[model samples]
Target: MHCSVPYPADHPFPIENLPYGVFSTAQDPEPRPGVAIGDCILDLAALTRTPLFAESPVPAPVFAEVRRAGSRESVSNLDAFVALERSSWRAFRRFLHGILSREEPLGDDVLVPRTSPETQMHMPITIGDYTDFYASYEHAFNCGSLIRGADKAMQPNWRHLPVAYHGRASSVVVSGTDFHRPSGQILASPGDSQPIFSPCKRLDYELEMGFVSGCFCLSIGAQARLTWHHMQIYGGKATQLGQRLSPQQAQEHIFGVVLLNDWSARDIQTWEYVPLGPFLSKNFCTTISPWIVSMDALEPFGVGQYAHEPALLPYLEHDGGVNYDVDLTVEIKADDDEYHVVSRSSMKHMYYTLGQMLAHHSTTGCSMRPGDLLGTGTLSAPRPDGLGSLLEKSKLGREPFGLGSRKDMTFLRDGDSVRLTGSARGKGYTIGFGHCEGTLLPALPLLD
Candidate 1:
């Protein structure tokens, strides 16, 4: 499908892939919802003001409500849009695909040049809660083997469930934001009796993908059988607080996917992550791409789930293509200002699928909210070149990889910048998460 809006054939956003985000132009300073269509953002706010949605099979009010709820503040967040019924989501995506594929060119009023200096992208969703999962078998095995030896690489419970930990939603930021290198307690040497408080000596980046959760439909017994649209309008009939979700039910809860960079301070993590999991090592900053590629758009690129040794529990078992074959790459920029591709991986390497991760999360009746995030941990591959993080590529800093001019490179430097990008290729099109990137700043001095 060709888009009337002119762009390269390989452009990440096309008529087939209308990823949503919040953007503001200099002329229009208020952030508003938009979808990237061939290098330009199709202004949803402007489209809503027009009569575009009048002919849609889905009620115009449904689309209007999402826009109104999301566009209320200075920085428009897609939380309200995420909370909409799944049917509305499908209708909206189809409507967008229909218009952009038309032969007639769209007007400037409804299109903003994405690369223009004035077009500013912001965090698409106001995340309520975040969970980071260790779901990659290769990544888990690599890290475990490096730390505890190959004999104990596979944790006893690793094959059973998708292991995860609650993450800090407050520190979740949009792409292009800079963050300081974290300072925390770490062992100065292997034999050190006590840990020393200092700036992180081993700073790293994790290449991962995250899925945003959609609406929370209250299960009102038989009334739950009501049409999703009517149930959305009536706000449902029950006040059930905690309810378990099967793998099939959990599939509908996912809104979209984005590239995620879970920055890590390895030294801090090594020192602190003992009885409990990662704390200060991870909570500092986690970056995500602005655009969210809808689950509908990703359906074309679906692939079979990775092989699981032990049979999955009934709740986590699902047939068909649960994982996506999105190609992921990590790059680092040094003083020269040119990005060097460091690692190449794929989401297909993930042992646990996003559906399984979400299903396991809510299996205990934990209430999940709209705009909640679930990260797929480090997506390392079996090959050495496909390692996701520097810790793995560098073998815990013992073997430093070579970059231009700087041969000894293991961890991130003060001025080094890391960028992560992902895309799934299709017949003459691409579905991509724009860019998840951030620069490292110098750490602050210790307390006096």
Candidate 2:
């Protein structure tokens, strides 16, 4: 897609990758939906107010609704856009693509554009709930071996279903927000008679990606199923009581993918996680990238899913399994004023695809709400350096990850900054999630 606006040839925000986000400027402090086109943000709200978008080949349902209601202002979040149907999603993108492309160009001067650096990004969606799934086979196997020993490595049910845990949505922060190290109860030894409350001794980051939704609500009791059939995926929760989502089309409901860093307190988690799963250890903080690269922009990067043993259930089985080929990386910038590439991996290492995770998530009919995040727990590969977390790279803090010959680290220090990035490569451009980053702050002083 050729565009009049100038952007770096290799920039992530190309005309073909119009990822959406919530942004504000010093002049306009109200957060509104915006699309990243090249290096500038195409103000969707402003565009909708003009007669140009009103001339789209297909009806623009999202803005049309707002226009009919006589509201010229933009909605504060993706709530309105998320409610849009598949056709509307396509129409909106097609309209923007058409206008931005040379085929049916519009004047760039009237769109109320903002250079990226001048604008501030906010939480794209008011996340209703969050769930982190252990979907990477290599990561799961490595961590399981380190924790449960080589003989008992993976759980019996791992191969059959996508395992997950409910995450704390309240702690889900947007990228650029640094957080203090969390403190929680810990056991001094494996068989300790008593527990101690203290700051985390082992702090780490999980390099993963998450998907948000625009579909209806899903609850555990009712259970939600991702009906993936005919190249369609619906986010609407299971409202028919026991009605299950089909497996024909499971990709439709997903808004897009974002880089996610699920910070972990290994000491606290190792002590508390058991039959009940992670609790206080996980509720403190989770970081996500600002922009959401919609599924539409990623369709070109899709390929057949990786092979796995053990047959999947009928609900989980589908033809032409789809998965994105995205390259991922993590880096650490410490107090020494240097950034070190700690690990580099790819999303293709994941044992189960995002669709499988969503399908398993709602298999019980759990209703998923718009902005609900589903994390692909710690993406890792078979190589030691390809591991996602310090736990695996350091072999549980026993070894140090190398940063040249002079520097090494087993776990993060107070001033350490970790950034996660990922992108789907295209012919001459890239579809990317800019950055999901967080700095480790000193934990608050402990009580006497």
Which candidate number has the best TM-score? 1
For 175-238, candidate 1 gives per-residue lDDT tens digits of 9999999999999998886999899999999999999988756453332322433234333322
Worst 10 residues of 1 by lDDT: 230-239
Which pairs clash in the backbone of model 1?
A: none
Per-residue lDDT tens digits for candidate 2, residues 69-105, read: 2243444667556655666777878777777775555
**For every model shown, what is its TM-score relative to the native structure?**
0.94, 0.89
lDDT at 224, model 2: 45
Error of 2 at 274 (Å): 0.8
